[model samples]
Target chain A: MSNIPEELHYSRSHEWIRRNEDGTVTVGITDHAQDLLGDMVYVELPEPGQRLAAGDECMVVESVKAASDVYSPLSGEVVAVNDQLADTPELVNQDPYGEGWLFTLQPAEEGEPEELMGAESYRKLIESES
Target chain B: MTLKTALYEQHLSLGGRMVDFGGWQMPLHYGSQIEEHHSVRKSAGMFDVSHMMIVDLAGERVREFMRLLLANDVGAEPRPGKAIYSCMLNEQGGVIDDLIVYDRADDGFRMVVNAATRDKDLAWIDRHARSFGVDVQARVDLAMIAAQGPEARERVMRVLGAEAPAGTETLRPFQAAWNDRLFVSRTGYTGEDGFEIILPEEEATGLWQRLHRGGLTPSGLGARDTLRLEAGMNLYGADMDENCTPLESGLAWTVAWDPADREFIGRAPLETQRSIGVTRKLKGLVLEARGVLRSGQRVECGASGEGVITSGSFSPTLGKAIALARMPSAAEGSCRVEIRGKMVDARIVKPPFVRNGKSCLQGSPTDE
Candidate 1:
């Protein structure tokens, strides 16, 4: 099972978004996703300042054994991406909620992050999946 | 249709991600595949390899039969419990299977074959043994677990404690020993020092829990593939199957053509191929990519026409993508791989890209 922090909201695709005090939503994969994929070898991130549509593939994470895309949870303008993943991708597996965070974005429409699940809801989803 | 091993219940209890590999429901990983890969490379990890079929062949002529059946001759004098790695071949010189033959005693040799090829291998052996008068018994009651990596042996031995047998102390590579009903062999898949233990299926959970308590991480097949690739070990299905000859799969060293008079199923055709030289050969490719490399991806070796990657992955130790490719015989030096519709440049490199957690490939053509 993967770790899901209680303070964050999660998308069905296994990404977590932490609404920061600065109004940007910090995005990263859930500990569950990283655990399933194994040791990450390469991480491709979105270029900051780019506008993104909800559910768009904004990044890619490649484990030594498999590769998968990181989809955006909400429509927004990309504000930041952790460039450190280029050389230390395993951070995603080791610290999915902290230093392993993928990117940050500013909401474009000031709208709700609809369809996003809270920690309890995500846990239920994981339970139902089992 | 066969029954699951003893770890079946435990796998489900631990929330293992299961996949049907070669018709067996096996754990791909518990959660993080990358962590599992690193755990073995850096610490220790264990795998459930019970799906590999084990057959014990007992007969008076076991030695002579194996000398004729396998690519590597194990008929040479050997102490009891010594194991030999060999390949079974077809009459056309193509590989039937690669197997381990354990010279358990003068009375018999035990053959461990790939799970997917169990039926065909059994049929082949039975058909060819018509005159050998051997008793072939498939051992369904046993399960196999391989503890691998630098700390694998120590962790496993710690768990076994007094159960670790004397014969295993000075056990040479591929040697086996049985003590208190547990069989331990100095063999592994990770290209690291380790041991494989075969025991009653019911006892697997006990050992698994012990190893878990001892901190031997439970890794899945996903990590196994990457580890074997880094070790330059050929995967049976990907690198070569029943349709490909060992000669073309970079396993020619396993074939013994000694005495010049001994006859084997594939000898005639293999001899012919050797004389004319193989048309296609397996080679390693290190990609200096703008993206990832994967199997079934076509490789364009400039002027050598098309080739294809059989197995490929990002090498954790090297921090780059590597692949074992089947390419034209004349192919050499450099090549390009078609990834996501792009022709990404790559270079031919010697395999064993990493061994024992150290990088073996350097100066890879990353510039192009």
Candidate 2:
């Protein structure tokens, strides 16, 4: 079983979001996503200041087996991106939720983040898929 | 229901992530695939390969039958215990299967073939053997394990106990010796010193446990794949199939054209192909950019036309993306590979990218 923090918001695509009090949000793939992918070899992060829609594929995570696109959870302007992942993409597998956060985005609107699923729902979603 | 190998329960107990490979449920990895790959290169690892079908052939005219069946010259000399790797070809010059044949003289010969091609290979051999009065026996009752790496042989020896066959350690590469119930072969797909042991199915789990206890990391299909890929070995279905001939699949050397009189299946077509010249050739590709190359990716050769990647992966040893591609014979030097829509620079080189834990390509930084 993968860790699903109750405070985090998730997308059906498996991206997790933690909305900050300052109106910005930190986003990365959940543990479940990384676990399925296995030993990430490379990560292509979205550029800072780039704008994305609610479901745009903003990045790519590649393992030895295959490559997968990381979709955005909510529309926003990318305020920061994880620069360390370029040389050390294993962080996404090591600390997916903490130091491995892919990027932070300033939401286009406050209500758009709430449309994503809660932790309990996302846990059930993974269960149903399995 | 999918087929299960003798080690199915052992895989589950080891936390293997199972996936359907061909028709058998096999482990893709235990925990981390990269770690398992590194383990084999740096130390020792074991893989359950009982899924590969072993067939025994015995007859008075076995040698003559083999000369007619295989493209290689495995029948001319009766060198006991000599293993010859050859491609079983069809009358159309297509590769029926690739296998290892161990000559045990008039007693019989043993052949190990790919699992997926078991039924077809058997049918083909049976159909041809009828005239030679040969008996084809599939040894499904045996379980095989590949113990590979620098320390693989030592670890396996610890588990083989005193009953280990004489000349076990002295067995030359591509040779096999049997002692008691054990059949130990100094052959493996990984480019390392190791032994592939064939034993009774009932005793397999015990040997697996003992090897694991002796420090042989229980590797899965994932590491086996990367190891073989790094070694520049061919996968039966992916690298070549019944639709492709050995001449174009980087297996021309495995075909013996000597004597010029032995008429093996597909010999005429191969001769025609050799005379007419082969249009396509298999080449190795090294990505000069930061991206993972995968199978089915397209290789653009500009005016020479394009080719597809037969097998591609992130080489853990080279720490770069590498692939084997079937390109136009005229495709030479470097080419741009279309990886996920981007033209990435790649260099073509003779394969065996990593051999004996070292890079074989000249000018490669890893060569140092």
Candidate 3:
């Protein structure tokens, strides 16, 4: 079973979002997503300040087995991107929720984050997927 | 329903991530694929290769039947315990499959063919065998295990018990020696010194467990792919299929043209192609930039002509991307690979990129 943090919000595409104090959100893929992809060899992060539409493919995570596109969970402007993944992509596999966060987003709409799935629903989603 | 190998239960117990491969449920990895790859290169590792179909051919005319059925000559006389790698071709000069044949003495030969091509290969062999009155017996009761890398032989020998064959330490490459029912061959796909053992299916799990206890890491198909790719080996379906011939797949050396009178299947078309010269040739690629090259990616050869990557990966041995591509025979010098819609410069080099657990290409220092 994969760990699902009770506080984090998740999208159907497997990206997790955590609301911050200033209303900006931190985002990354879930542990289950990284586990399915295996050891990551490279990570292409979206540029900070770039605008993204909901569900838009913004980055790529290349594992040893295959490359996967990371989609934006909600429309927003990229507030910050994880530069540490440039040399150490394995961090996504090691700590997917913490230090492995791909980027932070300032949401285009305040209600967009609520449209994402809660922890309980996301748990069922991954359970059905497995 | 997916087909299961004899060691399917063992793989599940050992944390193997199961995946569907060639209609069989096989392990993709037993934890971390990269760690398993490193284990094989630095020490020893074992892979359950029971999915590969083994067929035994027995008869007075078995050698003659092989000569007619395969593109490569089986020689005038079969040499006992000598394994020859060859490609089986259709009448159209397209490769049916690439296989290894072991002459097992007593006018008998044993062949190991790819799992996906098992049905076709058997049908082809049987169709040709009817004229020679030879017996083509599928050895489904047997299982195969490959123990590879630097310390592979030593670790396997430690657990092989007293019945293990004597002088196994001195068994030359491409040679096999049997100890009772156990057939151990000094050949492998990983480009490392090791043994590929074929034994009864019932004994497989026990042998695998002993090897694991004896310090041989249990690897899976995921590492197997990367290892073979780094070694510059051709995968049956990815590298070549029934639509392509060995000449264009970097397997010309495996085809024997000696003793001119030897007429094998596809001989006429191959001879014509040989005379006319080949257009595309399989070559190796080393990405000069940051990116992972994958199969089906386009190779931009500028005026030299375009090609496609047959097999590509991030070489764990070199810490960079490497691939095998079928490019124009006239393709000289360097080329660019269009990876993810971007052209990345790649150095064209002869294959066997990593051999004996070391880099064989020039300019790159061997990582010890």
Candidate 4:
């Protein structure tokens, strides 16, 4: 079973979002997504201040097998991008939720994160996929 | 429905991720593909290669049949137990498939062909063998395992123990030693010292288990692809198919054009192409920028000409992306590869990017 923290929200495309006190949300690929992708070789992150619509392809995560696109779960402006991934992409595989976070996003609208799937629904989603 | 090898159950037991390859359900990886690749380079690793079709040919006219059928000179190595790698081509000089043929002396010859081209290869062989009265039999009852890496031989030899044939340890490169049940060859797709063992189907699982128990990493097709790519080897369908010839696919060495009188299939067109000069040829590419190089990507060689990447991947050994691309002969030094609509700089280099667990690239950024 994949790790699904009770406090985090998930997207259908497998991105996990954590709401912060400053109203910005941090995003990263879920553990299940990293596991499925196997080893990470390169990661292309969205630039800071870049605006993204919901479901837009904001990033690309490449594994040894193939390259995959990471979509934005909600409309937001990229506030911060992970710089460590440029040299140590394996951090995405080693700690997908914490140190491997892809970026920090400031939401364009309030309560957009709540519209996404909750931990229970995300667990069920991954369960059905497996 | 996809076919299963004799070791399907074993792969499942070892947590292998199964994927559809050609027509068979084969393991893509046991766990981490990079780790498996590293294991093969650093120590020992094994691959279940039973899906490769083995065909046996016999009769008095067998030698004549092979001479006409193969692009390589099978007669060059008439010594028994010698293995010759060749491309079976169509009349138009396009590659039908690449295979290995082993001379069995009085017992005739044996060939191992790509599983994806099994039916086509059989039909082509059968159609030509008829006039020569050569007996063509597909040995589906046999299974093959490839043990590769520097320590692969020692581990395999230990596992075989007294059951191994005499002189098995001393088998020369591209040579085979066999008895009634087992055929062990000192040849492998990976650029490493190892053995390719062919035995009866029923004995495959047991051997696989024993080899694993003896400390051979159970590798899968994922690692196999990366390993072969780093070794500068070509994949049959990816690198060359019916539309491409051996001369253009960096396999000119495998084709024996000497003994001009030898009339092999596709010889005339190959000779004509050789005289006229081939416009495009296969070349290796090292991505100078971030991102993976994948098959079907467009390669822009500026004034030279445009081409496509036949096979490309993240080279675990090189710590960067590399590819086998078919480009115009004039294209050299550097080229640009379009990765997701962005043109990225890439360096043109001779392949065998990694061999014998070390980087072969000269002055490459990753070279240490």
Candidate 5:
């Protein structure tokens, strides 16, 4: 079984979102997503200040076996990116929820985070797929 | 339905991620592929290679038949237990499959071929063996395991103990020692010192457990691919196939043209190609930029013509992406590879990028 933290929200594409106090939303791949991708070797992060629409391919996570695209769940402007992944991509595999966070975004719309699936719904989605 | 090896249950118990490979359900990884690859390079790792087809050829005219079947001159090594790596070619000089043939002395010759090409290879061999009055028999009852790395031999020997053949300790590379229970060969695809042991199917689980207990890490095909690629070895379907000839596939060394009169299968086309010189040749590439290189990616060789990446991956050993590309024979120096719509620069280096746990590349950390 994969770890599904009750505090975080998730997208169907497997990105977990955490709401920040300043209206910025932090995003990273879920533990289930990382497990499927295996050992991450490289990560391509979107530049800060870049704008992304919902369901846009925002990042690329490469493992030894294959490369996968991480899509943005809510429309937003990228405020910050995870520079640590440039050197230590395995951090994504080691800690998908905490230190492995990909980037932070300032949401274009205030209610977008609530529209995303909660932890229970995300767990059910992954369970059905498996 | 896919076939399962005798170690299928064992793989599940060990948390192996199962996948379909060449019509067989096999393990892709046992948690982490990079760790498994490193284990094979630094310590000892074992791979269940039972999917490979083993065939025994026995007859009074076996030597004559092999000379006609293989691109490499098997006659060069007549000593029993000696192994020769060769490509079985078609009439057009295209590689049918690459295999290792062992001279089994009085018992005859034993060959191990790729699992995916089993039917075709067996059919081709059967078709040719008829005229030579040789008996071709597939040994499905046997299971093979490759234990590789610096300490692989010591670990395997400790696990096998008295079951190991008497001459096993002195066996050189490309040599095998066999008793009734086990056939241990000093050969591997990972460019590491190790043994490929073939034994009865029923005993595979016990041997695998013993080797595991003796400190041999159980690796899967995922690690196997990375290890072999880093070693600069070619994969059958990816690197070369029915459309590609040995002369163009960097396998010219395996083709023996000596003794002029030796008219082997596909010898004519190979000779003709050699006379005219091959247009495209296989070369190794090291990515100079970040992104990973993948198979089917276009390679721009500038003045030399466009080529394609035959095998490409993120090399866990080198910490960079490396690939085998079939490019114009004249291609050299720097080239550009198309990755995710962007042209990335890469350097053309000689194959065998890493050997014996050290980088073979010039200016690499280990080079000094």
Candidate 6:
């Protein structure tokens, strides 16, 4: 479950992002966030057209034990939010990488994703923790 | 090294996050706490409560011994297999530990004590037993697993299969059985209807495996804490300890002062406290803020004074943070909890933030 593919980038705030072929990018929480949060029971996501600055709290993930703020890794407008998580939040705990992806974002800055951690660096960060 | 329960190996096998709770290595959760909680409410769940010490008392004057030992009167027309919940108090009427006293039979009684206070309880009982000729034996060879919730009994029945033998589903709440091998008691920490099964230590793993196979999810100490808190049950060490009396801890009703002449260990102190009037009280608080609440956080009462949260957690059922705090009884001060270094607005209310698998708040309708 911890196999963060080499294609994605991570933020210190625990947001994982993967750039799309278009100008948009996919964003979600990392496996680390889901593990600490026990079982995710509910999620409140920002709307598709919602505007956000970098590091803005645009979403929330509520686990059985605690509720956590999901900060935006990059300045962007939400293009699409995961509709499935509204009913099945366990996917975030089950498959944090695949079906659990939160939303797509059209970056306000073209190269903002470069500031985030790459797959290699993110793996090192998580490894250092344990 | 301290002795762990029979399920220690089983919990490890199931990939349970193990933590030392009251000296026993117990599971906090199998994998997901939310699913485990939901499983109990919607279906069935099992918890290894083997850390709690089970003491079997046998002597001619066992009934008489309990009358003076507990704050709750047990000499009042008691029958076999019936149980009474009591607070074992110190000389000053402060609770030493709250425990269940079961009348196993004539001249046979058993008391279950908290694991943290096991040594204290044994010493207290042994010191007091000399006057009444009581024999106290702590049952460390046995293990206890609680199968709790609406569907818990059926799951146990399914696991037992043909070995199920007799009627356990019909066992009324708080009743116990000393059948051929198993000692099943219709009691639980979760507010739901359930049974606590006690058997030999060797048989625990097999029974646990069977229960798991029958759809009873395994829950650890973490889920157990939330479940008990949601049900408004008190944690002995946190909610109330030797420093406070039961009367001030919202447990005044559990103390029986009837017959008046019946003197218990803490009778003098309790009576003195009653006459002096209680100063501080234990109350519940539901957080209305954005941050998470935790123990040791200051709860501001007014401009002058403050309280502290003894036990706090996010209520899975209500989807809000809740806690029990020790504060002054007289209050016109609308309370607020100090969360994340900020004094956040909070509502001080009664103990139960939720009950019977339903939310019990004003203006908020029950969810499911």
**Candidates' lDDT values, in order?**
0.84, 0.90, 0.91, 0.93, 0.93, 0.83
The lowest-lDDT stretch of 10 consecutive residues in candidate 4 chain B is B359-368
Check candidate 4 and list the clashing pairs. Answer: none
How accurately is candidate 5 docked according to DockQ? 0.86
Tens digits of lDDT, candidate 3, B1-368: 67888899999999999999989999999879999999999999999999999999999898888888877776876587899899999998899999998988784888999999999989989999999999999999999999999999988888886757776767899998886779899999998889999999999988889889999999999999999999989999999888888889999998888777888988888888899999998999998688899999999888988999999988888988899999998886799999888889999999989998899889889676
Q: Would you list the rank order by DockQ, best first?
A: 4, 3, 5, 2, 1, 6
Alpha-carbon DockQ of candidate 1: 0.45
C-alpha displacement of A109 in model 1, angstroms? 3.9
RMSD for each of the candidates: 3.8, 1.4, 1.2, 1.3, 1.3, 4.5
lDDT of 2 by residue, B76-146 (tens): 77888888899999998899999999998766789999988999999999999999999999999999999
TM for every model, in the order presented, reads: 0.86, 0.97, 0.98, 0.98, 0.98, 0.82
| Model 1 root-mean-square deviation | 3.8
Q: What is the lDDT of residue A30 in candidate 5?
A: 95
Instruction: Going through the candidates in order, state the TM-score of chain A alone for each one.
Output: 0.95, 0.96, 0.96, 0.96, 0.96, 0.92
lDDT of 5 by residue, B1-368 (tens): 79999889999999999999999999999999999999999999999999999999999999989999999987844789999999999999999999999999888899999999999999999999999999999999999999999999999988888889989988999999999999999999998999999999999999999999999999999999988998889999999999999989989999999978998999999999999999999999999678788899999999999999999998888899999999999999999999888899999988988899988888767433
Q: What is the CAPRI rating of model 5's predicted complex?
A: high
Worst 10 residues of 4 chain A by lDDT: A110-119
* Model 2: residues with Cα > 4 Å off, grouped in runs: A112-115
**Lowest-sum lDDT 10-residue window in model 1 chain B:** B359-368
Q: For model 1, how does the per-residue alpha-carbon lDDT over B249-305 read when each residue is reduced to its tens digit?
A: 989988888967778679998899999998888988887764567889999988888
- Give the CAPRI rating of model 1: acceptable
- How is the predicted docking of candidate 4 categorized under the CAPRI scheme? high
Question: What stretches of model 6 exceed 4 Å from their correct place?
Answer: A9-29, A40-130, B161-167, B288-291, B303-305, B332-334
Question: Whole-model lDDT for model 4 versus the true structure?
Answer: 0.93
In model 3, which residue pairs have backbone atoms overlapping below 3 Å? none
